[model samples]
Target: MNAPLSLTTPAVSVDIAGVNLSYGTNHVLKDVNLAIEPGEFFAFLGPSGCGKTTLLRLIAGFNQADTGHVRIGGRDITDLPPWKRDVGMVFQSYALWPHMTVRRNVAFGLEERGVKRAEVERRVETALGLVGLAHLADRRPSQLSGGQQQRVAVARTVAIEPKVLLLDEPLSNLDAKMRVQVRRELRDLQQRLGLTTIFVTHDQEEANTICDRIAVMNDGIVQQVGTPMELYERPANLFVAGFLGTANILKGRIVGSGAERYFEIDGGTRFPIPEDDRIPDGAALVFRPQHATLTDQAGPQDGALSLPCIIANREFLGASIRYGARIGATEVAIDVPFQSGKYLFEIGSSGWLKLWPRSLHWLSV
Candidate 1:
């Protein structure tokens, strides 16, 4: 039997530089540049029609870039065809042939390449075992559940021992519970095999859960690329701030600048701004839902920005409560920890909103 490919040497790295793509007149990807580390689980995250899938296809050699270059393992493969690239792709549709048994589907790639019959059988068995489908090899795709069919698709991709694995929203079609279960299994399998993998998803939760690092894209441009924590805490711009989580934006003018920046809201309410040199004389203030608090206490404390507001609505979200309040003409959303001891205010209840100055982020006007 042929032994499994060992990744003792450094695994292959994928790189793209100044990549651009267009279908006739409509530009899809615009001057995109990214690097995927060897044996790392990297994710491309964005909404629909945001060029995330197009970028994946470029890496897999299914679509060529209109400009720039694509390199694998430090070798330029811009002109290489799909078959010669040695990349495994798992699509969202499961793409399994209904006529072929699970074993034949898993061995399809090797069979087409004219691999020996004995080696194909051995590799197919090994791949099926890896995905926990060894006993069901004789069953057709129609006989398996959605989750099982997805696993078969994964097994088929891995059977060829490709240099890189590309997954394009492979779990999107499954039910919610099945998606969670299969995602855990897929992540475990990828880590155990030490395969260089690139995952594309429109679901932020999925990317945050499985990816070692993620690149957030929008409108044919990459907005930010970092670890989950980095993207959540220090987003590069307004789009990322609103995209990753809920953000409360406030308009204000810079009253003071330099080390001790401060701003005044519409009600002449003064608040200290976080130390950011980029914020000019006029800018907007942005903060997360958790950063603002609805407290009974009045007056300003050290490092706190106070605002007068009336509770407009309250929503129950399991362990936390989302409170919507109106401050003058602006509405603010605040997420507070659920507790029995805390005072539960009714609608139209007037109170003071306290926010930490350090938690506030400045945005250009």
Candidate 2:
């Protein structure tokens, strides 16, 4: 069990500079640099083997960076031991002591530091209460539900009043419904305590819904870092655009010159590219499926490009319908909101899609 939290501890900023780590020839993290604001709920998001967890461990002092500086609240702690760093880590496994009662688990840290019995009791009770598990203080971890056990882990971490909180996939053990519920609670708790938090998760939805900013990583390198909206709307590269959301990448070549310039797909379908900048010679056009609309008519619009396509398949997604369309030699995706019995098209039927020129994004191939 962890001690009760005191909101008086001011949250601290975290800075990682030129961090490089590797297990022999693997080269896990590559010159990673990040600046996390004080009291910010930040997430390190990526797929497995992306080094998100390794980066989190480095901050927590569990993994040593071969060449980098780690500073918390402007104090260099790159060489500090884990216990001396004053950072609380809630691991993926929940790491609870099954034999001990919840209260004792929460109080373990305080007791280890030689806090008086009365104070430990007070803080332990308060911590358990904060997690809504005060009544279960005497229960063992094996006797509690998964969500309860997760709460116990959090209570244990928060009770220490560490300057920063590190969470490594804390919600991965919970069911889908419980994950949603507990994540909300976690956000609320972090805000109330004003703790600088860094959460590592492979789930995009978890990162998008819970954190204020996210750093997307892949191949042991940081790809893009931004708020969810920024990354989704204006990605920095092809990897970011494709990873953050469902993007329909269409390859094309820039044809003509000046105001008459347009991108012509391989199959003769054309769409106007934005002016004021040089379009890369072999850049690709990208757009989300939702940005396009489908219609039976095959005609261009004043501000839209109409592409003749055939419906290859349709998927019912409860609130919306997704259609897989074939245009020329490329396949594009179209999303339409479900309206009870809106016009339904057969799989093999031909349809036209209207895509706004402004909605089309360009990226280097």
Candidate 3:
């Protein structure tokens, strides 16, 4: 399982510096910059049409940039065509040739590269063996399962032993349960090969589970880049906060002077800002649902801000309970650990959301 691909070079770094791409009047990628470390599993995470796929193709030499350079292992590959770039890309659809057997599909790339007959057979066998699909080599793409087809696509790509592996939503077509299984397999395969891989996906959970780090994108812009926990806990802005997970963003006016500032939640109570915290212009109060707990009474909560809220709705999650409450002119969600036999808060009941002061973040719009 180790070094089965017989890669010529060690894992290489991919640097996209000042890259910008557009189509006439439509701007796609905007000033995108990233440094993918050697042998690191990285991901471009964002919604569809955020230029994630375009960026991946750009690295694979399928898309050209209007400005900046793309360097692979310090070599300027910005001008090379796709085949000469020494990069392998697994498309979203897992584009398999239905007419070909599994063995032929994986061997196609090697054959096209003018690889020797003996070498092509050896590499194809090794690639299929690496993916645990050698037994099904004679089966056609239509005869294999969806997950199997995807592995064939991966096998074909790795058979080339490219410097960098680019995956564009490779798991999007599978069922939820199959997706979980295949992603773990993908992670294992990547680790065994020590390949520097870049995965493009809109699903945050997929990126968080397997990738080493993620570059969060939005509107063709690189909004923020960090580990999954970093982006979720300390997001750069409102979009990052809301996109990563369920976030409660309360917008309102700021009252009082410099040292005595307060966030007045629209038609609701004023929450005092921490003296050490800085509030940017047009910033809103941001916090995750789990950061706050619901209580029947406001008592004295040290280092916590108690917001008076009325329980408007409730949802029973397996491990926790989610409560939708109304405070002032806004609605926010609160999650409490579910305890069997514990008295549930009634709908329309007046309660308080006990928010930890340390968990609060003031972010701009």
lDDT of 3 by residue, 1-365 (tens): 52367888999999999999998998999999999899999999999899999999999988999999999999999999998899999999999999999999999999999999999999998999998999999999999999999999999999999999999999999999999999999999999999999999999999999999999999999999999999999999999999998999999878886678888978868877777777888889999999998888786497788888889999999899999999987899988899999889999999988888789888987
Q: For residues 165-258, could you state the per-residue lDDT of candidate 1 as single tens digits? A: 9999999999999999999999998997889999999998889898899999999999999998899888877778788879887776777566
Q: Sort all candidates by TM-score, best to worst.
A: 3, 2, 1
- Residue 344 of candidate 1: its Cα lDDT? 77
Q: Score residue 362 of candidate 2 by CA lDDT.
A: 79
Look at candidate 3 and tell me the lDDT of residue 203. Answer: 96
Better structure of 1 and 2 per TM-score: 2
lDDT by residue (230-337, candidate 2, tens digit) is 999988878888988799999978888878888788788876665775566688988999999899986887667888898999999998999999988898888999
Pick out the ten consecutive residues of candidate 1 with the lowest summed lDDT: 1-10
Q: Comparing 2 and 3 by lDDT, which wins?
A: 3
| Pairs with backbone N, CA or C atoms under 3 Å apart (clashes), candidate 1 | none
- Residue 58, candidate 1: C-alpha displacement in angstroms: 1.0
Name the top lDDT candidate: 3
Q: Count the backbone clashes (under 3 Å) in each candidate.
A: 0, 6, 0
Q: How many backbone clashes does candidate 3 have?
A: 0
Models ranked on lDDT: 3, 2, 1
Better of 1 and 2 by lDDT: 2
